[model samples]
Target: MQKLPLTLLLATVATTSAQAEGWYGSAKLNSARQNLSSALLTSPRVNERVDAPDNTKTFTPAFAVGYAFMEGWRLEGEYTMPSSSTFKSYWAPFNANVNSLDTHSQRLMLNGYKDIPLNDWLSFYGMAGVGLARIDSDGYQTNETRRFAGNRRHNFAYSVGLGLDAKVSEKVTLGVGYRYVSMGDVETGYNTFANRITARDEQLKGKLKEQNLFLEARVAF
Candidate 1:
């Protein structure tokens, strides 16, 4: 009788372990918005500070792959590609000109998640991750007709988010989440003083903060 009970316990443990470990893939649609710091552009000729456009909103796409190592813990890798944003600035000097900037961004992140089960069909999760962002910018000054491109910048990035997941089937889940990302300063395309008679090393740069509202579809293998 004792041997039979021990064998049944082992079987139960094995079954639970098998159910907890698997590979998964996910895709998310993101509505992204940015908050930029002041002093985006500068020139020796004009002492006035130029600020980046505020509350820029864009739609972006995201993807991820992960493995569940335990019942409530997982590790994932994610990527986001955002569309170009247009921003304008002005200098109040005599030869006043409207300057335009086009910016694009992409990020790669590795994250860890802790899942809390609320019921048989519902769960909540929290995740935190670190990433690297690649930012590219190009700009032109209308007055001088001078167009310039900045060197692409690779900056450190990080995000934190909370989400709710609804199990649609044995292998499918749907999720909704909110995420906040911190992106460090990046050099803008106007860094060069090509139109000026004197060359200076000062570069134009700005800090970026982003918020994302994302809807996700995930499948377990």
Candidate 2:
């Protein structure tokens, strides 16, 4: 099982500071929650859509690097390395299925927002960004009824985010945001020899919405 490299993860955060121009940077430690829609991925044979536990929590730590083009108007590149969780799916006899694939992701975002000062210590702003999520799935699938199931591969997904930002300090901000992400449809085997097919239709796929509660720290030159 290959995990995220420690050096790469640290470098991602280190870039938040030491930027130039309208160049600004931020770092946030947050709680990331996903709303997985279980109905859309159900098998046609399994008439009853069996419900599964939907809470996969992660210690989401991310960073953003943006530049103010003109006063309040800003544009930047954002990155978040959210740890991978067990991509679990359900089928008849094999209800609890997790093929060891270390499904992890990192997102790059493009943002736009306005910062309005409410008081000397309290400032607020609203922002929106498009997220490009990259995922790597390398797991083991043991199914007696499936053929050629589970492989090591990478998938790219995306999400749209809208949020509010609060300037808590001259160098810090509080953020609350919602992201509607395309989780895509996950396919599982019906039998040990039922040629396994797992495809994520970019268009018309299952959706997973994520809500993030975060705190950001910035350093202004």
Candidate 3:
């Protein structure tokens, strides 16, 4: 019957409107690995390019405030705290390895998520975000000699992830997820050796990427 179809449609709309709808805040801890593309180090004296190694893993923290506007959609703004990792690079020209070199990053993002209910207390979700990141380095050193000054740069960043969320209470949810993020590029300052300036103090440049596994908790209002 035509009237029966209309009644079912109205019921469906009502059901959707009654689903999760409110503002929420979340906190997350991420086990992150920083992957640096092979960097090129340039200098006038060297007369050739040199390559550097990538970075290691570290833990970082992130926080977000979001609004669940519809049954399965939400938007949030997230901020990731700065985390650092140490790496060593061998400079053939100097004939030594740079020690205690550290790099770190901080990010701010606007993210959107879509969720699908799997059961009464569980849901699966996917998310994507676009943002800005600031990457910094503490320069390079070999033994007691400083070869370059540190530098910082701001770049465009983006991420994508998937996860499962469990509702423990009407107001609390917990989740675990994995995401891949691109933090853009970074560069080091001009070269300096033994407290003296070089004739052509070229810089080192590289691209930065990250893979993160995160655990999070959210509370709705």
Candidate 4:
């Protein structure tokens, strides 16, 4: 279409071509509690009597940095600090009680985004990126007397997200977003501790995943 360039340019009226090329920082409070599927509670091998479902909720903080180039493309890197969550599971005297675990991750993303004009004061955009995350995790059995596996493992990660913007001025854009993320299999070794008397690492949690909500602000150059 002859008007394609104009159409694209017009869509950014609320944003300004004067946007600069530099590093922008963002901090966000997640909207949803991430789902950490429990391993001990759900593993069928832990004896059917001990077999339940493992589900815990977590809220984590998110941060990111981006470099804008040619007023369009961006190279981004984001990180989510791990959160600790505790829950109880019942099976028997030997393997019944609470379990505590901490999870953390870092992501390197190559992203593509388009800015659209919603009005004189509003703009909308969507971003899609492919990235990998390094996930570190650890878990412990609730019993104070007996020690279960309290080991750590690392994994790969990936994500996708979308957002909308409210232009406060020619240089500032307020935005909100939602994202879906996944972490690859987090492995805890069978017997790699000083004392191999732990009972929590009887099985693996496998691939871990999560969903996050983000609120952001952008200062366009």
Candidate 5:
């Protein structure tokens, strides 16, 4: 009976070693940065263009699932809904209360990863992917808040990431990574003055670039 148990244990270990392919699920806690482009506006007194300060950094979370199809390659799909960030224009000539926005985004991506093994328990990986993103915003002007009727746009986005992973158990790994993402320009049209003033009624434009530093936990089966 003792010999039989030892034989089974060795056989199980051999099987696990031979089969390095499995399904994995992961969750990440992300620290994100937001960037915006310059804006140009015209007021009754003058016309001015200004680059506003970057939005506040926010903490967001993301989730993904993947399968290792070969020894060093995996494919994954992920979803993230980042928290809202605010932007306010700071051009001196115009009215101070006329141009503020609240912005947020949701994204879905299909990514491919290549892993390089440093040792039995450590690896480094790089990944690239394409995705769809929707950017939404609300505009606030002088005395009223306006919802831009056609403000939301769906963009084709891309991302790249590099990371280090360490195996902590038979079925678990821990990861730390940095990722960069670019979502194209978003435009919005507004009528906050309710037709009383049509001269300054125009569209708002901005481009988005983001970076994320994250810690992830992944489980494989």
Candidate 6:
């Protein structure tokens, strides 16, 4: 009778371990650099599309929970925290120079990952995700005389990444990765004052893209 109880206990432990191996939660910190495509400024008085200035960089965080449904394959839902960057650019003819324009973004994604075991303690992974991004910007002065308004929009976003993972322990893994993200387009609101005075109610539109380097940690539960 005692042996039977011991056998049941062993079976329960094995089952629990097996179940825990498939579920994991992770957190990551990313150093992301923003790349903006050419921006178009449209208004009744001026309609011009010109190249944007330079890249902006920020630090962001992400979190995910996943289940390994099959060997070497996993699916996860992740949330990227909001981050912001600022840019300054000059527009010719209109003499509209942006003193400071700030942009912000946040995203929610569903990702699938394929892992290949390189050794007993090392693995390589590639991942792709699709999601929605919320993009917004803050109003700023142009040429210290005219001020532009800000707007918010939601757009479809996607990302792809590849990385190497190190198994630190039975339940923990650490990784470093690079990802490319496309966040669709962002737009700014028209300045009402400009509209009334110079009939220059203009809005700026630009595509937002990013390259990110990240460090991540995952724990299996």
Which is the better candidate, 5 or 6, if ranked by lDDT? Answer: 6
Give me the candidate number with maximum lDDT.
3
lDDT of 5 by residue, 7-51 (tens): 877765644433369899989998988776655333443466554
Tens-digit lDDT track of model 2 for 1-221 = 23568666554433332112356677777677755455233334333323443556777888878776544456767788766655344445445542222345566777676555443334455666765666543334344232223322233454555556555544565666555555443333222333234433111013344566666675443
| Cα lDDT computed for each candidate against the true fold | 0.75, 0.50, 0.79, 0.56, 0.74, 0.78
Q: Compare candidates 2 and 5 on lDDT and give the better one.
A: 5
Pick the winner on lDDT between candidates 2 and 4. 4
> How much does each candidate deviate from the true structure in C-alpha RMSD?
5.6, 13.5, 4.4, 5.4, 6.0, 7.1
Clashes of each: 0, 11, 0, 6, 0, 0
Model 3 CA deviation exceeding 4 Å by range: 1-19, 44-52, 91-95, 99-101, 194-197
List runs of model 6 lying over 4 Å from the truth: 1-21, 44-51, 143-145, 195-197
Q: Residues 79-135, candidate 6, lDDT per residue (tens digit)?
A: 999988776665655555553456899999999988876655677889999999999
Model 5 clash count equals 0
Ranking by lDDT: 3, 6, 1, 5, 4, 2
Can you give the TM-score per candidate against the true fold?
A: 0.80, 0.61, 0.83, 0.68, 0.81, 0.83
Off by over 4 Å in 5: 1-19, 38-46, 95-98, 142-150, 194-200
Give the higher-TM-score candidate: 2 or 5: 5
Candidate 4, residues 169-214, lDDT tens digits: the string is 6567678888777766553333233223433335335456667677
> Which 10 consecutive positions of candidate 4 have the poorest summed lDDT?
187-196
